[model samples]
Target: MNQTAGLAVGHYILLKDPITGNPLAGNPRKIENIDVATRTVTWGTAYAPVNVTMNAVKVLFHNAAFETFGRVDSGGYLTLADQAAPEGSPANAAWLWSDGTSRALRVRTKDGITSSLNNGGTGTVAMGDTDRTPAASVHQCGVIVTTGTLTSHRLLTLPPATDTDAYGKWIDNTCTGAFSVVVRQSTGATVSVPNGAKAYVWLDSRGVTKLM
Candidate 1:
């Protein structure tokens, strides 16, 4: 039974279905091997032996990579430890997906346009001694310049956007505190804005917050 006898050059021999975790069923769909000891096999000895690999898979995680040849778990699945990485690298694990035991089948991401950045608009937020956290809509208006008078230190929490999120703000610390407007995302670290300063905040594809 020659599996590659009539197959085309670019035939995609699917070892397993990643979404459903199913193996390539039937004999015609799979090429059999004489033994499992050897990693590479040659089709014909009479002619020049073309090396064919049974399975060569490399799963990347964090700052390293792991590879295995012709190795399957009890479930007939390659069974990567349910991992993912930033599109650029495996080290950028800033934002995490759902804490699930299985890998995602598919993922979708879109760039978020703040109201101001989207339409060249501007808005003014009036700060108060009590009202420090403004609504998410206030930040959407492209560029923001804050107004208000403070008597003590205050924090202004900014809402995070979707992928590729960014906004610019001119902080007017009217309060008499050491740090007037300390900006931060709900789930991110903080960047303090002293008495008077300007900051452009951005979130990359991983949604890690940073001052741009």
Candidate 2:
């Protein structure tokens, strides 16, 4: 079996059905190994060793804008955008995607963590000056900030938990009182964030109550 040109390991090859001239069942097979000297190609454990003819097989190319296992569309392929958080289940975080309009992928926290710096604050701290509103598509994380003397307590309010399984982070910067930092969710639930402590909060859809 001779190896074909431009074919390398990890490339997916589609095996066509001989009779129907269509992709065979489970057609796309990954190239596991290639040996140029012996002229052999291996496609995992599913495919048998066969002479590599480039024209005989179809190769799938990688899409730079899309991630692996992304949704395919008529235009080409759709990258992963933000996903709805699953209730009581481990799921993937929100990801940036293209929809032809916005090329910039923006993920923001309560602070000034922007996507431009890969969400790294770079040692700079932002004040909790503005209140954040809740949206269906965005996940918000709030970090309490204290200015001047930490004598007076500051309050941080989170948006209503309208969406199921909504999650966020609350960081208390106030140094004086353990109850200095407070967080109030839309469900009338209030939590006092500990000084210099961070808490992960999520809304349990089953009970409709916010949990820390």
Q: 28-88, model 1: which lDDT tens digit per residue? A: 1222233334433233221223444544332111121234322468988754333343245
Q: After superposition, how far is residue 162 of candidate 2 from its true place, in Å?
A: 4.6
Quote the RMSD, in angstroms, for model 1. 17.4
Residue by residue across 46-139, what tens digits does model 2's lDDT show? 3353444444444444322323435758899665554332223213333333333444434433333333212331111222443333232222
**Candidate 1 wrong stretches, greater than 4 Å:** 1-120, 162-178, 204-212
Alpha carbon lDDT of each predicted model: 0.45, 0.46
lDDT of 1 at 147: 70
